[model samples]
Target: MSPQQKALILLEKQGNFKVGSRSIPTPGTGQLLVKVYSAALNPVDYKIQVDGIFVTHYPAVLGVDIAGIVEELGEGVENFREGDKVLAHGNFYMIDQGAFQQYTLAVATFTAKIPSSQSFDSAATVPLGVDTAVAGLYGKHLGAGITPPWAKIVNDHEPKKPIVILGGSSSVGSYTIQLARLSGFYPIITTASPSNEDLVKDYGATHFFDRHLSASQLMVAINKVTDSPIRIVYDAISLPETQSVGWGLLAQNGILVLTLPALVKEDEGKGRKAVHTIGSPHLPHNNQELFRSSWGMIEKWLLEGIIQPNNREILPNGLEGIIGGLERMRMEQVSGTKLVAHPQETK
Candidate 1:
């Protein structure tokens, strides 16, 4: 019989999450079996439970951000070995690949070594957040299609441009701000509560505004900062009001990138477009080459501080603690921090 491990299970569609037991899965070709130390929670995890949107199978384990030690390697896997500390973007669609389990399989392409300077909790906050930001900013179809920093033809002295990001404190938003800076965007304007101004600024936001400002007020504030055309507005929050503000701020022939479906209609006369993005690397619309190239650099970036992990708050009670953490996220009580659970600590 296969060995058993504890998992946070979603028993049914829109059902309650419970601590349960499941068999530890073996690694397949080019995969690694990781002993999960930390699993970070995202808003999507809670939304999946509340809305029953993604998973089709009953009795599923759901989690996407994982940080742990590789325990076994599959055939033809040469880049990683057993006992290497690593982080991976989990694929929750596969029951055994989810991070809620004590042991999960990670694809080699989506996994990276955790730098010595980082912890399991900090590394757990990176995978999904950074990948989502990458999809939104660099993906050809799902995003603004901007030239990625790693591209060969990218100019080191490219002209500076202006950008606006709503919800600068969110995991995706914060990563987007940092990538925008790397792409030579100037005056990286972002909106968030005053309490997160410093945090967002540290992530490379050059201008900060209170999110409570009306669309007109935000427009006025942004105008005073830059005269350049607002070519890209990333609505990381994607609420109706934020989408409206982003749509209104976009220039002719520009694009508005949204994490959720776009509620604002595009004006054909102005040629401004709104694009909804799916951030998963497994998705067809996400550029495969882009992620493959970028995932290779995650370790180096984290080591050099080019990318910063989200501020994380560790929850108690191991796998059981994830239930309360998801509830806090759903209630909008978790602010400016990612929630991480130690799955191996489950009893």
Candidate 2:
């Protein structure tokens, strides 16, 4: 490996990203310089490429999720060292360390050892999805009351109420269903295309309603399955129509959690809590702890084979692949699939 290497860079104020060479970064305190083997692309990447929401500098790298081997560790980094295989959710808002490059730096708390049994591409897909799902589920106290029967029997306590997952076929939605079920919530209902009903059910969704169904029809389907209304709702697809249907199914004490902002005004009189899950800021003391715990849980699930990586299709042209991939993603509505790229191929 050289002291400097080529990377795919998104130039500031430019509509497109380009392949270029830059000095390889040395890890700063509490960070590891990882030799990236695989990188996963999310819808957010395309949005940032076009809208430039969180980027602070020009010619920045654009990937947020990566999996690879550690080549160097910064001073005070104890949990990892050279040659350790790891998966990281690199900070996108940071100018120097984004993952769409041959080598990227990541903070210790935001990374975890990759399960030996998983491939680099498979490991790459877990961090962002896991973090988003965990944050939405536990960070906001969505299914906190739900405890598994084994846990209840051991602890001698009752289970928590049920929660609903909208858009269960999406990558985040799929994980949300499994996590909710793992927490011991009963009747984990979800809405998705009819074609995905079986797949969602396989992931612990107790019941599936067609997203194409009318709101009244959807509510009726949910009611026939469980008398207990949805106590907590995670709207993975936070569209106006979906929110209307989700809010309609909410039980009196239920809360609604959305990945995107809720466009509709909340009726304080309705007695349901509605909140959006925002990105974590650097200043809050608890943010690091929350981020670490989320990675730990994801690692445990990956090792145990309880949660599997979502389906992925590799983009072959490396850095040159972004334009076509982003275009396809926008036009095709890539539901329930992940796209990945390998930067080394571009060189």
C-alpha TM-score for every candidate: 0.98, 0.90
- Candidate 2 on 143-197: residue-level lDDT in tens? 2233332233433265545778999988788888887777767788888888888
Task: Tell me how many residue pairs clash in candidate 1.
Answer: 0
Root-mean-square deviation per candidate:
1.1, 2.9
Clashes of 2: 1
TM-score between candidate 1 and the true structure: 0.98
Query: What does candidate 1's lDDT look like per residue over 250-273, in tens digits?
Result: 899999999999898865588988
List candidate 2 segments past 4 Å from native: 140-157, 279-286
lDDT of 2: 0.76
Scanning candidate 2 in windows of ten residues, the lowest lDDT window is: 142-151
